[model samples]
Target: MKTYIHNFIAYKELLKELVQRDIRIKYRRSFLGMLWSVLNPLGMMIIMTLVFSHVFRAGIDNFPVYLMCGQVIFNFFNEATTMAMQSILGNAPLIRKVYLPKYLFPMSKVCSCFVNLLTSCIALALVVVVTRTPLTWKLVLFVFPILYVFLFSLGIGILLSAVVVTFRDLQHLYGVIITGLTYLTPIFYPIEILPGWVKTLVEMNPLTSFVEMFRDAVLYGVVPGMELHIRCIAACVVALVLGIWSFIKQQDTFILKV
Candidate 1:
């Protein structure tokens, strides 16, 4: 792990080039360009505010703000993982043609997705202001969970990138699986409404804790307590260890196939 960090720091220029290439490819030939990043989440915020807030009539305090907090983070995870699935395969030409660290492919995609996350976060802040949402320092606690989510996504992204390089078919399965998981997650709806058995079962998924943590901090101004923090840390550790170990073991042979 220390060696990987040292090598990444040593090859900062290569990382920069990869990140830049990813950013360019994302918005290439698009009129909206980077604004598209903020627009998707922001637009979904409005739609959720309208559909769930106005139409379905779920009783919650500041439902729009609640929805946006979950929306932004959930979308970030969904987009980052799916996009990074093909990260290595998409860069097969460069990886085969050059000597840059292969891990940079996944890292670069994560950076690009965070670029979008930052934009959506800013837009969400503006919405809070416009909606007269109360501000509190406790909301800052969200940074911890968001950071954990990033680490979680990074590990998962790297692992999936390796798999996708070998099996392109997994890319399609990823989308279907994530869509199903999204429903199981409490993004658009409250978790309390979930049945007892379902609640117990779904809570086993780390994303449940993550989405709940985000809603707690951003919407309710209450940070998740120690138990949730421990769970998040455990998730990140498991993902990192497994993902990095797999990549390191198999990455050398990646060039032969990818």
Candidate 2:
């Protein structure tokens, strides 16, 4: 851990460059540019609110606000994970030419997503205020959940960069998998809406706590469930360990594979 941290600190310039490259290239040819990032999620949330709130007759009051909270967070994860999948192979030139820390590629995208997520936070705060949601000091509890998000993203990004470099098809396969994972997640509905047995499975998913934690802080102003909190922490630790192990094991072969 110390070595990885030290390596990251040493290669901080590469990280910043990568982050800037992502922000620039992401919308470089587009008309709306970065606004599209803010709008896509917002537009999806609006459609969802119209469909789910009115059509499905979801019992969730303030479904717009509730759903937006989940959408914003999910978008962050989606962007981070998708970008991380290509982090290594996309930078093959740098990988071949440079001697910096290899992990910096994916972590840089995570940092870029971090900036995007911060912008979404401002959008989320506006939603909360416009919708007249209650506020309390408990909102400070968001720190813990956001930290988990960053760690969780780091863990997954590092692991995927290693795998995707070798199995290129994973780049396409993950898109399908993430689509399924999105619906399987309770971003649009409450846990109560799910079957009891299904809730057990959902609770086991680390994203469950992250989503719930967001809602708790932004909507209800309460702490997350203890059981889910424990599960979330455990999941993050396991994932982080696996990611680091995989990176260390597979990185030696990256040049040959790429």
Candidate 3:
């Protein structure tokens, strides 16, 4: 573990380069460029707010802010993990020639996505201000959920980066899983609208806890309960530990597979 830490620190510059490259590649040739990160969520929020706010009658105060919070959290996790799944195979030429720590590739992807997450938060803040959502000291606590979700996504990304190198089909299958997860996450809808069993399943989702914690701070203006804090921390730790363990165990064989 010490060696791994040493190598990661040693290659920190390379990681920064990779992260910058990702951000550049993402916006390259796009007319809107990075602004899309901010606009995309705001646009989606407008559309969903019109549709669900009336159709579902979500009844929550500041529905747009509620919706934006969920979108920002879930979108970060989705984008980070999806991009990380391709980190290994996408850089196969470099991997075949280089001696860099393989984990850095996926780590860089997650870091780049985090940059977008911050921009999306700007959109959320704009909506909060526009809708006149009350700002409270609890807004500071919003950072906790973001940090928890970042760690959780990093773990999932690392694990996927390793596994997808060999099971290339997983790249497609993961899209389906993400779509299913989106609906199960209560992004635009309230959990109370779900059937009891369905609500239980959604609550069990780690993303659910993170989303709720974020809403508690940013949308509802309440501090997240201790139970939520513990749940988010536990989920982040478990996912990260499992991701790192799997990556280490399988890294040796990656050369052969990739």
Candidate 4:
């Protein structure tokens, strides 16, 4: 791990350049450019508010903020992992040309999306202020869940980057899976609305904890309890371990596949 960290630090400049290139390409030829990051989620929040707020509003006070919280975090993971899945094939030339850490491609993609996620947080902050959601000390610890989501996303990203190099269909299949996950995730609705049996299934999802953690800190204005902290940490550790293992094992042949 120390050697890996040292190698990453040695190539930090290359990683930065890759991340910047990603951000530029994402916004290239667009007039609004990066502003779309903030607006896209805000626009979705407005649509969701108008459509579903009437149904779930009673249970979730500040429904827009609640909705935005789930949307931003889930979208971050989705975008990051999606990009990471394509990172290897997308940069086949770079991989072929020189010696570079193969994992850096996926890591750079995840980091770039993280930057976009941070920009989208402007919309969340606006919603919070506009709705007058209570500001509390718990909000200061909001970084905990964000860190968990990043680690989880990074783990999944590494795993997918390795897998997708060989199984190109995974890219398409993942799109469908992400669509299903969005609805199944209880993003716009509170889990309490579900019956006990169904609620258990939803709660079992690792992403659910991240979304719920966000609600707890930002909307509910309470510190996340030990259960949430433990769950997030466990999820992060498990995913990261699996991701690193998978990536290391498969990356040996990624050049041939890509």
Candidate 5:
């Protein structure tokens, strides 16, 4: 592990450049450039607020902020994993000619999406201010959920990048999966509206915990129970370990596959 850490550290500059390159390419032809990171989610929130706010009818005040909270977490995870899945095959030319750490390619993709997630948070904050939402000390605890989601997404990205190199079909499959998950998560609706079995299923979903945590901090302003925290931590750690292990095992043959 120390050897891997040292190697990654040695290639930190390469990783930074890869991340920067992705950010540039993402907005290369756009007029707003990075500003779209903020605008895109905000635009989605407006549409969601207009559509789902009436359909779901949650008692939660400031439904836009409530909805944006879920959007911020879900969108980050989706975007990060989607890009990471293509990272290896996308950079095949570089891998063929270079000696850089292979994992850095996917890691850089995750880092770049994280940068976008931060911008989306700015949009969320503006909504909070415009809605005149009350602030509480527990709002500071929002970082915990955000950190867990980051780790969880990073792990998933690593795993996907490793697998997608060989199973190119996963890219299409994951799009469907993410769309299903968005509805499974209580993004626009209250968990109480779910049937008991569905509620249990949602509770078991890792993203559910992160969404609930974000709602707890940003919307409810209460600290989540320790059990919830443990669950999120366990999910992140397990996914990360499995992802890293899978990548290390498969990376040896990636050159041939890509």
Candidate 6:
């Protein structure tokens, strides 16, 4: 762990360049650039709000805010892990010639998506202002959930980056998993509408804890309970420990594989 930390500090500048490269690649040839980050989730929120709030009648107050909260958290996880999964393969040429820590590649991807996450939160703030939702001191506590989700995503990204190098088929499999995960997460609808068993399953999802904690802070103006803090911390710890362990164990073989 000390060695890892030392290497990370030593190569911090390389990480910065990798993160900048990702942000540039993401916006390359795009007319709107970073504005799309703000607009994409906002647009999705508007469409879903129309369908669920009007058509299906989700019956939730400030549904746009509620929906955007989930989008901001879940979308970051999706983007971070997807990009990180490709980090090793995508930078194969560099990895071959360089002696830098392989973990930096996926770490940079997560950092880049974090920039997008912040911009998406701007969109969420706009919806809150437009909808006249009351802002409370609890809104400041939104940082806690964001931090929790960031760590969780980073751990998952690191784990996937290592595993995907060995099992290239995981790239395709993960897409299907992500699609299923989206519906399993209560983004557009309330959990109350689901049956008891389904509710328990949904609640079991780690993302559910992150999403609900975010909503409690930003949308509902409530500090997340102790249970949420415990769950989020546990998830973060387990993911990071497993991810780092796997990466360290397999990194020496990455050059041959990639």
Per-candidate Cα lDDT values, in order, are 0.82, 0.82, 0.93, 0.92, 0.92, 0.93
- Candidate 3, which segments miss by more than 4 Å at Cα? none
Candidate 1's TM-score: 0.94
Per lDDT, what order, best first? 6, 3, 5, 4, 1, 2
* Residue 165 in model 2: lDDT: 83
lDDT string, candidate 4, 1-258, tens digits: 898899999999999999999999999999999999999999999999999999988898889999999998899999999999999999998788888989999999999999998899898999999889889888877788888999999999999999998889998899899998887798999898998988998898899999999889888888889999999999999999999999989977877877
Per-residue error for 14 in candidate 1, Å, reads 1.5
- For model 1, name the residue pairs that clash: none
**Which of the predicted structures, 1 or 2, would earn the higher lDDT when compared with the native?**
1
Give Cα distance to truth, residue 203, candidate 3, Å.
0.5
Kindly report which residue pairs in candidate 5 clash with one another: none
Off by over 4 Å in 1: 54-56
lDDT of 3 by residue, 207-233 (tens): 999999999999888988999999999
Off by over 4 Å in 2: 55-58
The TM-score that candidate 6 achieves is 0.98
lDDT of 3 at 240: 93
Candidate 5: which stretches are off by over 4 Å?
none
The TM-scores of all predictions, comma-separated, are: 0.94, 0.93, 0.98, 0.97, 0.97, 0.98
**For model 1, how does the per-residue alpha-carbon lDDT over 8-121 read when each residue is reduced to its tens digit?**
999988878877888898899999999887778778888778778764345677777878887777788888888887888888898888887788888788878877888888
Candidate 6 C-alpha lDDT tens digits along 1-258: 799899999999999999999999999999999999999998999888877787446468888898889999999999999999999999999999979899999999999999999999999999999999999999999999899999999999999999999999999999999998898898888888899999999998899999999999998898788989999999999999999999999999999999
In terms of lDDT, model 6 sits at 0.93
| Model 6: colliding residue pairs | none
What's the CA RMSD for each of the models?
1.6, 1.7, 0.9, 1.0, 1.0, 1.0
Against the correct fold, how does model 5 do in TM-score? 0.97
